[model samples]
Target: MVDWAAYTLVFVAGLITALATGIGALPFFFVPDISEKFNVGLWGVASGIMMAASIFGLIPEGLNAGPWTTVAVGLVAGGLLVLVANDLLMDADIDSRTYEEADFKKLVLILGVLTVHSFPEGIAIGVSFAELNLGSGIPLLGFTVPALAIAMTIAISIHNIPEGVAISIPLRTMGVAEWKMVWWSIFSSLPQPLGAVIAFGFVQLAEPLLPAGFGFAAGAMIYLVLSEFIPDALEAGEELDGKGYRELVAGFAAGGGAMVLLLVVV
Candidate 1:
């Protein structure tokens, strides 16, 4: 009994996050110049939001659904998934320029790298919707949407904005058109809908694995925040005062605190 309607709704929710990435690129449309200080802050903000979502939303939810051991296993497995993917693609570096200019074979390679980047967010969206319409939640359109699902979706969508800014930075350096920057930002996240559908279908069938699923998504997401986002922020802030540590911390506190508040509400 595949609930096509639910699947469609979830996919659309995921797509909304993907589209939100485009919003990051929108600032370039208005101004040809954006300060590096602002860029560092943007990365810091995105990292904070991601870290908070994983810590507050995903892990606790996993614990509530099942034993800590199951969540631990999922977390370890998720980290390993990222580790292995990075190891495989260690020599292959893809950047915004590569995104715009890559031909067929090159395109395939970059997409593989991006899978490691984006799929976990999709999984997060999917697992949050595990209960879907079966439990009490907010009604939207015609379906009873889970509150966690809505929270996770918004969290990811907001995080994607700064991520879009990061992506647009290099493209801006190359003078890529504003619309193309937005398109490429969205393109990077296109797999999310499929990832969401797959995770949703899997959890729906194996209800027992819900905790592990939550752990898996949380683990991957947090790993990314640590390994990728934080480092990127630091690298961007290398020339800034205090090496941008103050800005990073400030952004982290703001982003995490905001998500915590949202979690409290929903």
Candidate 2:
């Protein structure tokens, strides 16, 4: 009973978002350099969007689908995964920000480690599309795409822009070409399409795990924001003389507001 067409569509949606990450690097083509304060602010916005998507979109949907305990467990497990990934990355001396410095093997190793974070985001997108064509939902490409699916896709795509910038920043500093920066940014999220397809398949096969899946995605994203995004932003803006905090707050507000607006309109 699998709808291969819908599955392909979902995968494409995820892939599009992943590709959107490359667009973040486009700014560097026009500007000689972007300010550190703005970069930190962008991270703040990404953090806010991820947190909002997790809290407002993912968790509530999860609760509606299954038991509280299931969601709680998934949340904790997702957070722990991020924590462990961070430890591993630190030990390996392979943060995404410094990808240019890594040798080929280390580059591959870091990308593999990043999948721990990116794959869950893909899962979140895939799982959101579970109800495609089953009931009343937004119309897209001859299918009844769920509103949540659309929202999640947009949220994740927007959140990814800052990530692309983060990756591009270091490469830019290393004197890499603008085009290469774009390629590297897209490469960072390349796992998303595979993750989306796999998650979609799993959920379709075992409907009961849907709620836990939501929790897992939500937890991973929120934890990533708190543990990685904010800290990185602070570090980037360290020399900004208290402007970092202000930018963080402003960016958070803008991101959250934009997400809420998207949800409301959609």
Q: What's the lDDT for all of these models?
A: 0.73, 0.73
lDDT, candidate 2, 164-260, per-residue tens: 6655654554556899879888888887888788878887554556577678767777777776668767878888979599888888887777666
Q: How many residue pairs clash in each candidate?
A: 0, 0
Model 2 misplacement above 4 A: 1-14, 93-181, 199-206
lDDT of 1 by residue, 1-266 (tens): 87899999999989998898789889889886657676667666666766677788778977987899999999898777666655555545555444353332233333333444566577778878888888799999898889999988998897677657656655564467899878988888887787788888886544556678668867776776677668767887899999989888887887777767766765
Using all chains and alpha carbons, the TM-scores for the candidates as numbered come to 0.66, 0.68
Off by over 4 Å in 1: 1-28, 93-177, 188-192, 195-206
RMSD of each: 5.1, 4.9
In angstroms, give how far residue 152 of model 1 lies from its true place. Answer: 8.0
